[model samples]
Target: MKNRNLIIIMISLLTIISCENSYAEIRWEKNLATAIKKAKSKNLPIMIDIYTDWCSWCKELDKNTYSNEEVIETAKKMVSVKLNPENSEEGEEIARKYGVQGYPTILFINADGFVLENVGGYVEGEKFVPYMKNAIDKLGKINVILSSKEPSLEKLDLYMESGNETEATKIFNDLLGKKSIPDEAMPKYLLGFGLIRAQQSDYDGANSYFDRIIKEYPKSEEVYMAHYYKAVGMILSGDTDKPKKYLENLIKNSNIPNNIKTQYQTLLSYINED
Candidate 1:
């Protein structure tokens, strides 16, 4: 009986090792610099898996999502790196830079160091592939834009779409300085950046962006949305009085649609109750 039990234990250990090897098919680079260098050399993007030791979902992502054959195959087209924010100062700084709020946050960045996509939370393998494919498509578009000699504003739309705010702002400032930006595009550019700032929880910065649209392009259709988001940001930032006052003024604006007015009125009522 003892010998039989020992044989069963050996088989279980072997089975576990086999499963582990299956998960190890995709090589994960530990050093960000090395991964970036590899991606640059190969003209590929970098896929960063930002995880923590204590995160159970992160482990599930590794065992279930990353181990999927489809995911392993897709990852071959890019450099995959794992980062533990709690492990090293470099990891912590990188996580902070990318605005990582939760574990298993996947970042897809192009060779030019611009972010292509930021995927937060855990997703299954099938859902995860689309994000990777989208990032890859964006990288291709960025490369095409770089290889062209088109006007700067033509590329501005792509930059904003990819969440490359730094480049988008540079182009925006240049166009604004030269008075070359189209009137219709200004509100959109401002609104995009404002939404991005809001997503990052930088309510003050978001309000500033939204304010630009309200002040500069008051007659534009986007002005209503800009005002709405600005008020929402004020509320999010804990300025109860300002949001109420702002929403009241917005509700009074004649240009606002009846539906939007109702929406704003509802929000205002909620705040008043609060």
Candidate 2:
């Protein structure tokens, strides 16, 4: 009878452990298409967790970050999708579209099917929660832009042209910081323009903003403009020597738009003449 009781107790303990593991909620999806479809149907934002199977950091994010109560709760409000970059075509497409060159890329896509943000690599729960919140806030802003009857781009341009540099800078900076804006050429152009205006007479301030655009938005259409402006700012501030190297780099960079390159070259000629 005692042996029977021991066997029964062991069986009950095993059952309880199995149940606990099984009940542990792992919010994951296999494919982008399916995830998108579900998000669209349910009117939820899409959160893509880009990972590689062999990545230890990726596993840690899954085990610790994703399992954190705050992260899990916040994540439940959106459609969660997992993509293994090494295995799936859908995953590869998302990775390529967002310029995700490395593992553990977290993408937050707004309801209208536009990518709001692309966060790369791993962070712990404390840091991760704020990141997610910021992404969510950006998603909210996108919704506001979409709901407005007036065109957002036009309003943005008006703000820029009217010399409301502070407001324009705020909007763009907010968008960039929040990851609420799309990875479009036009917005980046406007952002670079706004930053230039804000630092018009302040070379140090201007250089900092220009450098940020260069470092963070390398593929932006405004890259040449950023380079040119950086050189101009440096030159105007009597930091002429530093400008020469960047000007040379701009001239050498084959990817720069032709018209912009010509503009920079013209400016360089003027600087040399004086």
Candidate 3:
């Protein structure tokens, strides 16, 4: 009886290991030509996962982000392809064309082979799902925006203010692509503000924009506000450590205004009360 039980356990362990290995080993294409050909044949959009072998975050994205259920389901609608930037000339060319300066860039290309968007870095399931959905939805609006004779910020702002978040996001992304908008203090600040207001209920959206603000405009006054808003959004989203970390950063930053410091302290106290 003991020998039989041990054999059963070993079989179970082997099965589990096989499944795990299968999931870990993804079908990576060497070049974009194959992906494009497949996309044309299948009449599907292409999703290219650009990475290098040495990138730890790239591995995490493969293991966690792309393995996510929603990501996998959404990817099924498209021609999924993985390319190593260092290994393939075609992949390198695509990365250069799309302005991918970093590893783990995910490019969503239209059926016609035009690069729609280039999203970089590792993102978990919750954040990744919304980004994919937004990217898919934005393609149509991008056509409209690009075809328009006068593509103005007003139109973009209207879309943003009118609750057409997907369209607004696309317009902003398009603007960024064309280099029409400056990445100066003012533009980043405005974009961050708009994202915060537009996605008040969307903790992930708010967090994303606030994070950009912190990264891009660390010296700007908006950083303090962004930190506060990020903390609030994180707390609401059940990210326990983020709120505390943001608060602590704000508290330590001597450049923060007295009123903002007071507010941060008050919020911190409130959070710690229970």
Candidate 4:
């Protein structure tokens, strides 16, 4: 069993080394620490391919998934690392830290060692390209937020969806201190502040933040959605009149999407009929 494990580790390492010479050209680091260094210096996210030698799916990733031209091309954009937890103490330790619950888990992480995404199972070129691009896009967006250069509604929405209050607090605090917060980030900032408050059941506070977005960033699309959520909060607080009037005004706006319009329209219908 011991020898077989060693053989597996060797095969995986050689496979990674072979990639450097391949036409597709993926430079995969065998040691994660080395990969982390490269990621930081190069300003690239780390893509860790977690697999075991015995797993058929792991082998399939090599022959099918990783072999794709598109996959190889995308891999070039990252600090690539491949490890089989059985290889060394460093490998096992890294595996546990990342919570590798199963075989063939692909971890997307930043240079700061913050985990971005954990993609399980296998993905083909068509699906894989976008899957990878999505993570990279998110990494760029997150960097902008982290750098306080730009803020993204998508990032805020993601943090809210995942219940990541800690990061949200950090982002909120970061934005609060900046003397000149860009107009691009302001709408997301207001909407995110409102969303965070709403998640905590602070309806009045949430509405205040949402109202700020409407009053200050009136031209932003966030205002339309903000009105919808604020109206929902009003209904929850048993104040039908105010929320209903707000919704009535929301539905009249042609700039908002059909869904946002329908959301307000549906809520008002329910409130009036009740």
lDDT order of candidates, best first?
1, 4, 2, 3
Q: On residues 199-228, what C-alpha lDDT tens digit does candidate 4 reach at each position? A: 667899899989899899888988887888
Q: Tell me how candidate 4 scores on lDDT.
A: 0.77
Give residue 73's lDDT in candidate 2 (0 to 100). Answer: 74
Per-model TM against the reference: 0.77, 0.54, 0.44, 0.49
Per lDDT, the best of the predicted structures is: 1
* Best model per TM-score: 1
Can you write out model 1's per-residue Cα lDDT over 46-126, one digit (the tens) per residue? 998898999999999988898888888889888999989898775797787677889889999986667888899999877
- Model 2 segments beyond 4 Å from truth? 1-23, 154-225, 228-274
Error of 3 at 196 (Å): 29
Candidate 2 has which clashing residue pairs, if any? none
Q: How many residue pairs clash in each candidate?
A: 0, 0, 0, 0
Q: Point out where model 3 deviates above 4 Å.
A: 1-30, 140-274
RMSD of candidates 1 onward, in order: 5.2, 12.8, 14.1, 10.3
Minimum summed lDDT over a 10-residue window in model 2 is located at: 154-163
Task: Say what the RMSD of model 1 is.
Answer: 5.2
Residue-wise C-alpha lDDT for candidate 3, range 115-184, written one tens digit per residue: 5556788887657877666657665665566567564675565454434556667777777678776656
- For candidate 1, the 10 contiguous residues with the lowest summed lDDT are 149-158
In order, the Cα lDDT scores of the candidates are: 0.85, 0.71, 0.71, 0.77
Candidate 4, superposed: residue stretches over 4 Å from native: 1-21, 149-274
User: Per-residue lDDT of 31-100 in model 2, one digit per residue for the tens?
Assistant: 7777778877876778888889888999999888887778877876677888876788888876765557
